[model samples]
Target: MLLPLPAQAAALDGSQLSLLWGVPFAGILLSIAIWPLIAPMVWHHHFGKIAAAWALAFVLPFTVVYGLSATAHGLVHALVAEYIPFILLLTALFTVSGGIYIRGNLHGSPLLNTGILAAGAMLASFMGTTGASMLLIRPLIRANDNRKHNVHVIVFFIFIVSNIGGSLTPLGDPPLFLGFLKGVTFFWTAGHIIWDTLFLVGTLLVIFYLLDRFLYAKEGVQRQDDPTPDTVKFGFNGGRNFVLLAAIIALVLMSGLWRSGISFDIYGTELTLQALVRDIGLIAVIIASLVITPYSVHEDNQFGWEPMKEVAKLFAGIFLTIIPVIAMLQAGTNGPFGAVVRAVTNADGSPNPAMYFWATGLLSSFLDNAPTYLVFFNTAGGDAVHLMGPMASTLAAISAGAVFMGANTYIGNAPNLMVKAIAEDRGVKMPSFFGYMAWSAGILLPLFVVVTLLFFR
Candidate 1:
C-alpha cells in the first residue's frame, strides 16, 4: 500500500481554498469546545508547553505569508490523511509494548550495551523507527536507570533507532514508501542500505565508546550496592493491549488495499493504480483509524486518553490557525517558489533530483513532510524527462531526505509527537520542543550534512 512519489506529482493549481481553510479551522474550533473534556490530558505539563510552542511555530509564519503564496489544497489533505493510519499504528505500537519496562544492569561492560543498541537498531528497520524507539526507549532508560550519565545513551538511541537504521525498506519509514509507489523497484531502496547502515553503526560505536569511557570513570563516584540476585524479571502491567495495536495495523493495511482501487478517468488519461491508491487511501485510513482504533483499543486498555487528547489539542491549534494563510499561499504564490523549482532543469529540460532532495527536505523539517514530498514529486513529472535512470535516482534521494531527516524534531513527523507522548507515558521526561531541536541540531544535522555531501550532492 505504499504510494509512489510520482503519484503525488501535481502542480500547485489552486482550487477549494475555502474548504481547505474551513475544514481544518472547524476541526480546531470543535476541538477547543471539547477542551474541557480534554483538560486533564491537554493540560499536562510536557504537552501543554509543546502545544504552546507548536501553535507559535505554525501561527507566526502563517500570518507573515498569508497572501503571498499558493498551494494545492487537495494535495495537502491527501498527504495528511494518507499517513494518518501509519501514525496511529506507531502510536499503538509504543502504547502496548510494555511502554517502558526495562530490566538489566548498568554495570555491564560497554561492549555489552553497544551490542544491545545494535539489536535495537535492527528491530527499528523492520518494525519502524518510532516503534523501535518507543519499545526500546523505556528499556534503555531502565538499563541506565542506576547511572547518572545516561543522556548520551538516549541521544544515540534517537540517532540510530529513530533515524538511521530504517534506511533500507518501505516498511521502515513513510518516505521510503513514497519511492516504492513511484516505480522504484521494491528492493531498489536497499541500494543505500550498505552506506546508511555503516554510517549508523560506525557513528554509534564511536559515540557510545566515548560516552562509556567517561561514564564508567564516574561509576565509582556514585556507585550503589548491587540489588539482590535473580531479580531481573520485568513485568508489563498493561500487557493485553497488543491486540488493540494489531487491530490498528490490520485496519491500516486493509484501508490501504481497499483505496488502491478507487480511481477515475480524467481528460482521457486513466489514473494509474498508484495515483488511485494515494488519493483514496488517505480518506479510507483516516476515517477507519479514528473511528475503529480508538473504540477497539478502549475496550481493553483504558488509559485516560491523555496522550491522544494532548496531540489533538496541539494539532487542532496548528491546523485551524494556519488554514487561511496556507489557503492564500496556495491561491497565488507559485511564481517565486515554483520558479525556483521549475527553472532548474536538466540538460534536456527535465527536473533536477538533487535540488528536489534539498528543497523538499529543508521545508519538510518545518511543514508537513508528506505534503512537501508530494509537492516536489508532482512538480517533476515523468514526462519532464524521457530518460529513466537519473529521474528514478533523483526521486529516491528526495524520498530518503523527507522520511529520514524528519526524525530531527518533535513536529517534523507525525510519529515524532506520538513517540514523545508514549515516552512520557512511561515516565521518561523527553526534551522540550526547542530542547529536542538542540538534540537534533547536534546529532541529526551533522548526519544530514554528511548525507548531503556523500549522496545528494
Candidate 2:
C-alpha cells in the first residue's frame, strides 16, 4: 500500500528505523557479485540461451528480496520509498536488452543501415528507448552487415537511441514525467523542442560521418571469393508490430488522464482513480503487444526470441542487485538537502535547481533517476518561495535534466543496457561498463555543459 509522504516520514522517524540504508546498498553489492557470471557471456555474445541463465542470476534475487521487504514489518516503508527507482531500473533493463532483432542480417549497405539507424533512434524516444532500440538493433547490425568495427556503431546508437533521443516530450522520458507530475505545463517541455531537435540531428550526422569513415576503411579487405550474404529489407519483417507499438503509446497517453493522488470518495473510501487507470492501461498495452506481434513474426522468418530473452536475463540481475541500494537511498533522504551534500539555494533565496540538476542527475545515473529526481524536487520545494512559475520552471528543468541525462551511461537510463544487450545479440560489440562512460564523458558531458549555459544560466 502506498503511504502518503507525511505518513511515510512519520513512520520512519517514529520507528527508530535508521538501518534502512542497508537494503539498497546490499542490492548494489549483489549486482557486483554476479558480474563475473554474466558479464563474460555478454562480452563474447554467447547469447543463444542466456535468458534462463539471467533469470536464475538476477530475477530470483530481486523477487526474494522484494518479497521479503514487502512483509518484514517496517520494511514496507523502504520498499515503497524505492518504488520509482525500481521501475526506472526495470525500464533501463528492458530498454538495454530490447526484444527486437540483435543479430546482424545477411545483407544491407552501411549507408542504408545508418539511415535506418537514425530513423530508429528518433523512433526510440517515442516507443520508449527500449522499444525502439529492441526493434531496430538487429536490423542495425545487419545493415552495417559486414563492418569489422561494429562496436562503434552500437556505441553511437546508445548515445542516440538510449540517451539523446528521449528529449522531445514527457512521453520521451521519465524525468519529463517528473515535470508533468509537478504541474509543469505539458507544452512547456515542448520549449525544449528546438534544442532537442538540434542535438538529435547533430548526434546522428556525427555518427554517420564516423561510421562512413570506418566502413570505408574496410573496403580493401573485401575479396571476390567471399560469399555475399542474403539481403534483408526494412518494413519487410514484423511490420505489423508497429501497429501494436502504436497501441501501447495510446495506452500510455490514456494513463495520464487517471493519476493517483491524494483524494477521497464518498463514505471516506480512498478512491485511487488515477492509479487504477494507469495500472490497467499498462497491463493492456503489454498484453496486446505480446499477443499481436507473434501473429506476423513467423511470416517474416523472424520468430527466434533472442532479444526478449536477453531482456529477461539481464534485467533480472539488475532488479535484484539494485533493490537494496534504492531502499537505502530512500531512507537517507531527510528533506530538501537531506543527507546529500549540495547547495539548495542562492543568496537571494532562489532554489538552486541547477545544482540540484547536476547532483541529482549524476547520482540518478549511478543510483536511480526517478527517486533522484524526486529527492531533488522535494529539496527544491522545501523553499517556501519556490511554489510559483520561475521556481516551477527551474524545478522542471532540474527534473528533465536528471531523467534525460541518466541515459548518458549504460546503467544511467532504464533502456540503455537493454539496447546494449540487443546490440550484442545482433553481433555488435557494445562497450564494457566503464568503457561506455568514456564516450559519455566526452560527448554527453559537453552537451550537458551547453545545456547548463542555454537553460540554467
Per-model RMSD to reference: 8.8, 7.2
Whole-model Cα lDDT of every candidate shown, in order: 0.53, 0.52
Q: Which tens-of-lDDT digit does each residue in 1-457 have in candidate 1?
A: 3233333323333343333333443344334334423573654455455545545554455445442222233325423533333344444444544232334334434675687678777766555665566556655555555555555666566666776676666556656554444444445566744475567467766778777867867675333543323255654433334444455444434433444553433322234454444445444433443443444333423334555555555554554344443334334224223354454446566666667666767766755565455555555542213213556656666666676666676556655665566556645566876788897788677777776677756
lDDT winner: 1
* Model 1 error, position 296 (Å): 18
CA deviation > 4 Å runs, candidate 1: 1-109, 178-186, 192-194, 221-230, 234-336, 340-353, 382-389, 414-439
Model 2 clash tally?
29
Candidate 1: Cα lDDT at 178: 47
Give one digit per residue, the lDDT tens place, for model 2 in 1-457: 4333322212223122334433443344234334434686553374323423443443345446544333232334222223332243234324222323333344444566567667765775566565566566666665554566667677777667665576655556666554444444444555744464456457655766676666756664343323435444334444445565565555445544545565433122233555345445555544554555444354333444454554444434443333333333333334222445236556666656567667777776775465456555545542313433557556645655665577667667656776676577766667887888887787677777776666666
Off by over 4 Å in 2: 1-114, 177-188, 192-197, 200-204, 207-211, 214-228, 231-233, 257-271, 295-341, 382-388
Task: For residue 95, give model 1's deviation from the true position in Å.
Answer: 6.1
